[model samples]
Target: MKTRSMYKAERTSLNRLPDPVLETILCLLPTKEAVRTSILSREWRYKWTHIPKLRFELRDTTSELTSDIETAMNAMDMYDVYRVLLLHRGPIHELTLYFDHYWEHYEAFECDQIILHLLRNHTLNKLTLFGLYETEDIWYKLPASVFALHHLTDLHLCTFDIDHPSIFNGFGSLQKLVLSYVKISTKTLLHLLSNCPSLNTLDLHIDDYEHVDNCTINELLKCLPLIEHLTISGDVSQWLVLDSVPQELPTLIHLKYLCLNQYCISGDYGSAFLLALIKCSPNLEHAHLEMEYLLEFSVVKDKYSDVWLAHLNTLDLCFCSSSLEIEFVKFMLARSPKLKKVSILTVVDRKQDAKMVKTLLRAPRASRGVKICTWK
Candidate 1:
């Protein structure tokens, strides 16, 4: 067994590792834990300050801690974030801040100041800021300076809104963007998408669909010609057919993965919207659809002709055991010649779900090797 002196010698030798290797090790630790390493030895005093990636999460302690204690801890955590940025020596390539505030009020001004400080460093490649709730009143308003990060490749913003898109310069290097419950106007949203030429992955979930219309939705689709993976959730999918059924929208030639959550495929208009997207995405390989409801009386037969999902390999559907949904499954099974697997998560009684699964298994498939799996 190793003695105390032997362990001390080994730790000293480990601490003497190259600065790059040491920084990498520190980066793997939590921001708070990394800061605690400064007390280990004199050599590790400023090691964490050079780490390129930093993540700070302020959690809510309403259940475990008293209100006063929780408030004090939150203030200290926020201060620590400021302290880390001030003492940080090198460039920060990525940063993530999650504020789980359950209090009635928060200092939005301090958060703005932190963003302002980050603006001085243009080397950020990935930035994720998630707020506690989706309300526009409490959500942090992203300043115009955020658009100046030209080197950003991946960005995820939740419950954030931009006031001035006119000052936006655009992210030319950005490839992946996720906007969850972001309150953005149609014009600003279009401007943001038109400038990102390299964007390939887009995950959009808009709660305020009243402000957006069908024409703007079509324009949004046009802006994402190079998108390979697309996810549309919330009420936005229903908004796709607000004005009229899409006849001819821009084809997403590069689209491979598609995910639709709480999307309605009921009625003629909804059917048209769904068919239009699938018709355009000829190269789609994987599709995940979570349906809200599919009315039996309103179900429309295939209107689009000469459509085939030749590249589709996997299909995942989460829906109630409605006849319209089963019909949709049968339609896809007949068209997807290369489909290998179909997974269904039924939101119905176990007996009804089993019967639905049996019906699907008996349906004629274009690909004889396709496997149908189901679970309730």
Candidate 2:
């Protein structure tokens, strides 16, 4: 009896599929795996060239085992990665590259060359570079070509050195930008925000306090006029002086969501900040806070409570150390007659506390449309 030829029949059927379908499947794969698919058949050889997404990783190949670790680490040079990117000539919709200092000296030069090559191609819509650190005198600056890529909608840079403000001079079509662990001045950030007029979301995480002096909250807020969502997380302890309170935030009136994490909203300045929110952001519907102390009755009376607690619809309170929870809740209920939903969140796990919240929710409320939730 003769055995059926399974491999030959499957290969023939695969060859019959149209290039678009094959390209779609190839696009779903990582850059390395997509390149490997060329070995499947002659038709599949250049399929990777049509893929829009490009992702390159060096850490994925390194072995953690003691015996093979050294060899694997040696093979994980940045130059090899750069050469691979140089060979790929296609319209990349997304590109992700990660670099490390463990690589040899020659790899740093190669990385620069790869970046220069990327500058020539203007099809990149989303670009992400992580773990990029300066090595020796090998300074890394954002290339001028990147600012001209009008198709770029999202850009994420982590731990990279950007020395020039001109690098972000002409990004008119960018929608989202995220920066972390980068040294950037307020002037540079303002330039970037002014260029990206279509920006909707921004996230900034600064690990060092030294760079805090370069950017003020007011200057940063002025950059994005049409921003709908904003998240600011950093050490604001140094910048929380009462005198630095903003006079107006006319542009931030359209903001629907706001998150302020690890921030100290204490003393009279905290009350002033809340008052500013009331005066500036009339359309703010959702608010989340992890404040140190809930505002006291005397502070609220002195500052005028009616301005700050009038128009809130959704409120989340978390990790508060103040003993004025009941008083605050009562005050909000009285002030926000239109309040729909309220969530009191606690950092510590307390089953009984959650049950007590449930009991409160079940009780009859004086306000007809109000719903309260306590999540522990």
Candidate 3:
């Protein structure tokens, strides 16, 4: 039963809250929204300066909005971001800036300096900077100082490459890292990962890999021993053994969650890759694998040694076509003793999906208690 005037009075009283409390409220808002509060009153004019986090977003999910920003900013938006950081006081807990850096007049060196300044001065817990897309102007490499953030906990950098540094001792406190369309050599990538001893999560999304070989790749993967959640999507054809066989296999003893999305590998290699992963991750609880594979002669036995996905409870197989893949699926069905449910996914119509489901339901399984299902 409160009148409209009473609500206004209550809201006006909120302006008198302690500065720390007001900064907490501002920290939850986006940088633009927080800055807008300055017009509310003289008391709120400087509250945004003390916020612990600042996020400047140039575009949202729509590509049209991206075009709009490109039209409006004319590639001068970096200065605005630099000014915002310059105005912010104290250590920023989190900073996420996503803007287009693809323009003929863009100053790559200045942007690099600005990013380095933020990393050097802030005690950031989460830092995400997504650079320009691949379909744009010249490529921009992130400053080597990005690897020297000792206070970062979660980092996601996109559309850039890192130069090999003479000395590396950063990302010691980092727990999660995500790289999208990042150009990195195997040797450099290994060196970076080796420095992050506390890292537990890694997500890689790239269109290609350079000079990828199995011998060194397998060895380097061993550097990340504590990773529990792993997601490798996009074009892995360069690293995945599609033209030949895996010369070496990497074992991960701590992995529990895995997702392989639309990898460009054939059936035999796909089956072999998944088997190798299952063998390595003994404690894996769930897996989602959906990709292309070879259509060669099936080579699967009733047993694949004493290896067991002992804790695995759910399996999702999607976009399968080859009969060799069916054998691999059957082999996994016979291999997983503790498996409780398996979902076979197909891109066919409802009738075809029903037929595949029926076929799989009739297939022999090692886990007598496992339920078989299908989806289209």
Candidate 4:
């Protein structure tokens, strides 16, 4: 009688679990674990497919499955994964696929065929694809079907070659885009950006910049009118300049954060670029600049330097080789009356310079809220 009562309590607890709660628990498990649950009962068989977030990863890890099952799983292909995906009738809100590096052994055409199949059926709101391609051949362009998925809000592509610009027409709803090691022309990039009017955040990790021609800083800024957060880490030395104050980018007036790292600021172009930023982002609240070149104030000697110091509330300067660090500090104290916080980090080993930085921060300013921290 006690055993019967215990069984009844267990059944009650299982029945009390809401479908959403059960789904959440299942979603957190690995794909293999989720699939194995199908053996439990008829209700569990189709439960894995109901998960809103689908992640399919293919790797050569030996520990992924038991020794006996690994061989059988290896015999199966992407088609099996596609079948599993098709079983899910619900909308796929987030989809991530990490293709195995061994994809080079298969025909490129086969890979494209499989990817096209996935893109056709999935209405992905967020998608991330990362894999090593077999070749740099032009035939490696992303499946054209991707452009038809207008529902995608966030897209991340890493180590992929986007050879065509027309593939961007369907990304009008995209709000965040991250690209790494992508090879595309500046014209293509402009065309892509023109479609994403709602884009608010952009992160770029460009290893190659030779394809960027016939596009200037002003033209790029004009395309992304609503971008509020911009994080750029690459070789912008070639393109960092503005010959004229941009009439465009007024919409970027809402831009509040900017981060630039490992950027080389040299030549007349650097000055123009800095001036354009100061003029365009008048409401910028936070900025980080890591300049890796010798400091020469030829272009921004007095006029532009004052503009930066006046507007910035939080500023972090890293790896600057300027001899006039004190001059910059004095300029900030005088121009940025409302500036309340500052962090100066010297990338090189320079413990002796902290004393001078401390002295500069203690100076009286219009904003008594000002605080400074220096680290080497």
Q: For model 1, what is the C-alpha lDDT against the true structure? A: 0.76
Q: Give the TM-score of candidate 2.
A: 0.75
Clashes of each: 0, 0, 4, 0
TM-score each candidate.
0.86, 0.75, 0.81, 0.78
Residues 126-212 of candidate 4 have per-residue lDDT tens digits of: 877766544343223454555666878988877666654343564778999887666666676778888888898888755456655
Choose the strongest candidate by lDDT.
Answer: 1
lDDT of all the models against the reference? 0.76, 0.61, 0.69, 0.64
**Over the stretch 1-376, how does candidate 3's per-residue lDDT look in tens digits?**
9998986787689887887788888887778778778877767777788888888764322233444653444223555667778888767888886665332245346556766887678777898877776553334567666666788889898876655568767578989999887777666677778888999999976543554443333654687899898887776656543444343456777888888875633434555555556677888888888755453424523224556777888888886545666666666676677788888777667777666656566666633778877766
The better-scoring model by lDDT among 2 and 4 is: 4
* Candidate 3 off by > 4 Å: 1-7, 13-28, 58-76, 102-104, 134-138, 208-217, 240-250, 294-297, 300-305, 337-341, 363-373
Cα displacement (Å) at residue 219, model 1: 1.2
Among these predicted structures, which one has the highest TM-score?
Answer: 1
List clashing residue pairs in candidate 4.
none
